[model samples]
Target: MSDNKLWEGSTPFKEKSHLFKYRNWLADNRNIYFNSYEEIWQWSVDNIGDFWESLWDYFNIIAHSPYKSVLETTTMPDFKWFDGARLNYSEHIFRHAQLEQSAIIFGNEQGDYSELSWKDLKKKVASMATYLKSIGVTKGDCVVAFLPNVPEATISFLAVNAIGAIWSSTSPDFGTESVIDRFAQIKPKVFITVDGYFYNGKPHDKTTVANNIASALPTLEKVIVLPYLKKEDVSGFPKDFIDIHTIFKTDGGELVFEPVDFNHPIWVLYSSGTTGLPKAIVHSHGGILLEHLKYMAFHNDVHKGEHYFWYTTTGWMMWNFLQSALLMGATIVLYDGSPTYPDFYKLWAFSENVKINHFGTSAPFLVASMKNKIAPKNNCNLSSIRSISSTGAPLPYEAFEYVYKNIKSDVWLCSMAGGTDVCTAFVGGTPFYAVYPSEIQCRALGVSLYAYNDDGQPVVDDLGEMVIDKPMPSMPIYFWNDPNKERYKASYFEHFPGKWRHGDFIKINSKTNGLVIYGRSDATLNRHGIRIGTSEIYRSINKIDTIEDSLIVNLELEGGNHYMPLFVKMKPTYKLTDTVKNQINGLLKKEYSPRHVPDEIIEVTDIPYTISGKKMEAPVKKILLKMPIEKSINIDSMKNPESIDFFLQFAKQI
Candidate 1:
C-alpha cells in the first residue's frame, strides 16, 4: 500500500479528460455528485441498473425502439439487458463520417501507407453491405472473414454488422485447421478472406489456404476474396469466387442500418481453444455498443478525431474492440503486418507518423523492447503519444520502469487485463487515477470485480480467483452450438454457481484500489499447500538476461508428492547451466518465499503460446501431468505447434 507512485494524475489532465466532462454533466443534469472515482465505482456497481441507464442517457444512445426496462434481472447466465429495444452497432460508427480527419490511417511492415476518408469508408461499407444483401445474406446469418488487420477487414465487419448479420474473423496467420475449427461451428453464410498477406517483409500467399478453408465449411454459401498478393492472377481461384473489388462496381449509394433486438448477436468471438475447439462467444449489438461507449469515454479517455491504434490481428478480440473507437468519432489506425518486422520500433514510428493519442500493444512487445534496449523516445518523435496501454499479460514492475526510464518520461502507462469472454477490460485506466508499477489503475466502473477465496467468498488485498458478482452488459449472450446453455453455464457460471469466474488469479490492493493480476489460476503453482502465481516466477526470471522465455507448472504426483518444474527457453547462444539455475532459484527465494522457487529447472527450445499471444500454461501443465496429448492440447490453437514436440517427449518421462 506504499505510495511509490509512477505518475500522478494532474489537475490539468483531469480538467481536459472525458471522464471529468461526464462527471460534470451528471452533476449538472441529474444532481448526482461524487468526490472520487472509488465513490462513483461503488455507486455504479451497487445500483447496476441505474448506472447502465445513466450511460444510455449520457451517451445519447440511438435506439430504434424504446426499451421497456433498463435491466431485467435474472440468474447469472440468463440476465437480460435493455430488452424491447433495437439498435445497430454499425450505425453509431458512421455518425462521425463528416469529420475532416481520415477515418482510418493504415500501414504495414512493408512501409506502405494508406488512408481512407470517412466518405470512402462509408461508400465501401455500403457497397459491401449491398453486395451481401444481393447474395441473400440477411439478419441473423453468420459472415466470417479470413484476413489481417487491414481497412478492408474493418469495412467487411461493418458491412456485415450493418445488415444485422453476425460477424467473426480470423487472421490469415492462423492455420487452416484453426480457422475452420472456429468458422465452421458458426455455419457462416459468407466467407470473406484475403488471397495473401505480408508479414516480416515476406508475402504469404493464402489463396489456396483460403480455398481449402472455404471447402471445409459446408455451410458457406459464398466466398469473397481480395487478391492482395496477386491481383492479376485469376487461375488459382474458383470461377464462382467473387472478387472483393466487384462489390463497389455499381456504387451502392446510401448505407442502411438494420434494426435488431438489443440482445441480438452482433459477432461471435472465439475463446483460445488450447484444450478443445474454441467456444464461439456471441455478444449482442446493444451490449457491445453500450460497453464500448462507457469504456472508451470513461476508462480510456480517448477524444474525438484523435488517432487510436492497437497492435492486433483479425483473430484477436482487440481487433473487434478497436473498431469501437469509431463509435466515439475517433479515427482508428490499422496496421496489417508485424509489429517487429523491420525493427522493434516499427509501431512507435507508425504512432509518430499517425500522431496516435492512445497507443496500445501487448506487454510482451514492451518487455521485448526493454530487453533489447530500444529507446523509442531516442529513435522517434513520440510527442504525439499520450497514453501507452499494455494488455495480453501483466506488465511487470521492471517493464514499467523501463517505459519511464527509456521510452518516455511523462507518458501515461496503463496495464489492463480482460479476456475474449467480455471483449473488454474489467480493470483499465482512468484519467482520475494515478499510475502505478505492476498494477492496473482501477476496476472499470459498473464492474463488480473481486478476488474470491477458495470458499467462494470475496477477499480484499489477497491472491484469489477473479470473479464478477454482478452482470456486465457485454458478457456473452451464449456460446454458439451450446444447446440448452449447458456449455455456457459450465464455462463460467458453474464454477461459482451464480458469479462469473474469470479463471485468472488477482489481488485487489484495498488501500490503493489497484489490481495486481497473477497468471492463470489453472496454471498456478502449489507447493506445501501454498499457491503461487507463474507471473511472480517470471518476474524473477525476466531479471536474468540468460532466459528468453519460461513456463512454470506444478504437478500433483500419484503419492501425494508435488513436482514443480521451471521450463526456460534460453536466449541465443546461451545454455541453461547450474549457475544460472541457482541464480533463478536464489533470486526467487530472496524476492518472494521458498515456495516461489521451482523444484527443477529445465531447458526447452520454445514455450507454446496461443495465436492470441497467451502462454499455453494450462495445456502444457496438462501434458506434463500425464494427460493424453490429443486431449491435453489442441495443436491448431498453438502459435508454434511444433514447439510442443519437446514438451510432449518431456511429458513421457514425468
Candidate 2:
C-alpha cells in the first residue's frame, strides 16, 4: 500500500501514531493478529468473541456486568454481541462534565457566539431532567422533540437519555402531519420543542405544529416549549403545553441517572418513507455510543477539548452523532440556520473563530456552494480544520478536488455514507488508509461489508447490493411499534434474510479498493435488462461545469416507457442557458449509454431534499407518476418543494 496518493498531493501529516490513545488502539493493534484487510476480516469471523472483546478493551467502553463473552455467534442473523453488559450511556458522556471545560460552543449565521461550560451544560441538563421527572417522565418512556441544531436541542436529548428515557427528534421544519406519523406511533409521553427557529433570515413557526401534534397524539401528556426566535407570550399554547422556563423552577433536586442494558433503546429514528409511511428505526444506546466513539476517536482523530461541529439539524442522524462528542470530552459547536446564509464564508468564519478540529456536512450543500461560487479562500482562516467529512449523497469526485484546491491543501476529505437505519455508517473514514475522491476509505473494520450479486454471493469491483454478512453492535434492537420484529426484519432482512442488505448500489473500486456508493439500489435504473445506479448519471452530470446541481430519477411514462428524467437547479446567478443544456446532453450521450441521456433537462429554482440533505429523487419520481402525495409525506423538511412542480411538468412533456 502506498501513502503518496492517500492524501492526493497534500502535505505530509502523521497518518499513524504509536501513542496508546483509546481511539487509536484499533489501528495500533490491527497488525498484531492480521496482516491485511482480508486477514483482519477473517479473524473477526473466526474469533468473533476475541474480536469484540478486544474492541471493548481497545475503545475503553465502560460497562457493568462485564461481558464474560464478546459474542455468541451461532449464525450471522441471530448473532448476539456483548451479552450481559450493563452501563449507563449517559454516564460515559457525563464523565466530561468537569466544571472548567467548555462543553458547547455555539454560533449562528448572523455572527454570534454562545459558550456553555461543562458545569453549565450539566447544570442545564440536570435542570431539564428534573423538569422531565416532575412531568412524570420515567424510564422506558418516549420524549419527542423538534428543534434546531442548537445547544438546547443537544442538552435536551442528553437529559432525556440521561434518565433512561428514549429521545426522538425532528427538525422544526417538519409539519404537524409528519411529526404525528412518527411520534404518534411511539406514543411519546413528553414533547420537547422550541417556539420557533431561524433559517435563511426568516423566522419559522412551530407553535401551531407542536400544538397540533400534542393534541393529536393521545399518548402525549405535555409539551415543553423553549422559546428561540419569538419570545412573545405563548398564550396560544395548548392547555397541555408548558413553558421551559417554568421547568427551570428551583423545585429540583440533584440529577438522578439511570443505568440500562447494552441493548437498551436510546432513540427511535425514521426513514424518509417517501415510498410509503416512514419506518421508525429504533437504535440502542450501547451500539450508537460505542460506534460513534470508535469513528470519532480513530477515524476523525478527535481529541478531548477539541472543537467539533457538524452542519445538521436535529432531524438528521449526524446531529445525534455530534452529541457523542460530550462523551469524548470535546466541545461541540452548534450552529443553527443556513450553513451559507448571510454570507458564503459563514461556516468558514465560524471555524476560524472556534478553531474547529473535525467538521462534517452533506455533499449537496458542498455542490451548491461550489455552484454558488462561495470560496472560503479570501475571508476565512480554515487552518484549524483537520477532517472534513461529507455524507447524505454520493459526493462527486470533482467535489473532492474542489475542496482540496479551494478549501485547504492539507485536509482529510472523508466521503461517508450511511443512513438512519443503523444510526451510523457502514462505509466511512479510517486513518490507516489514504483517501480517493468521492470514495469511502473502506467498509467499517468489523462490518463484514460486501457487494452481493443477484445470487446473494459476494463480489468485488462490481456494482451490487451493499450487504453485511455479520451483525454488529449498532444493529437496531427493533422498531418502535413493531413487537414481533416483523417490520424491523422486513426492512433489511427480508431481502437477504439473516444478512443486512443496505439498499445502496455500490462498487468497490478495483484500483483504489475504496467504495463508491453509486446510489440507492431501489433507485437503480434498469434499461434493456441492465441496472445502472443513479449516481452514475449524477457523477457525470455534476462534472459539467455549467450545471450547478441536479436530481436524476427513473420516470415511467404512460406507455410503460421508462427513461431517466433529470431536473437541475442552476446557480443563483447562472441560468440553464441553451449552450449549457446542450453541453450537458452531449456529455451524457458521449460518456454514458445513449439511454442515460435524460429525455428532458428541465430547469428549476431548486431541487427538493430531505432534512438529511439527500436529493428527494424518490418523491419527485412519485409526483411524476401523478400519484397524490399524502400529507404524511414530510416534504416540509425539504430544502425546496416548489421544484417538484417543475419535475412534474417535465414528465408531462416527455
The per-residue C-alpha lDDT of model 1 at residue 247 equals 86
Model 2 Cα lDDT, one tens digit per residue, 289-357? 777776676556677888888898888888888888776788988898888788777888888988998
What candidate 1 gets wrong by more than 4 Å, as runs, is none
lDDT measured at residue 535 in model 1 versus the true structure, 0 to 100: 88
Model 1 lDDT tens row, 1-654: 337788877899999988898888879988989999998999899999989999999888889999999888846988999999998999999887864569999988877799999988999999999999999999999999998898999999999999999999999999999999999899999999888888888889998899899999999889888877776565677889888888866687799999999999999999988889899999999999999999988988888889999999989999998999998889999998888878998888888888999899999998888877789989889999888889999888889989988888898887888989999999999988888789899999999989999999999988999999899999999999987889988988878999999999999998889998888988888777998988898888999987898988899998899999889999999999999999999999999998888889999999898999999989988998878877899899888999999988998897
Per-candidate alpha-carbon RMSD to the true structure: 1.1, 3.1
Worst 10 residues of 2 by lDDT: 10-19
CA lDDT, candidate 1, residue 432: 89
lDDT of each: 0.90, 0.76
Candidate 2, overall lDDT?
Answer: 0.76
> Residue 75 CA error for candidate 1 (Å)?
2.2
TM-score of each: 0.99, 0.92
Q: Evaluate residue 17 in candidate 2 and report its C-alpha lDDT on the 0 to 100 scale.
A: 26
For candidate 1, the TM-score is: 0.99
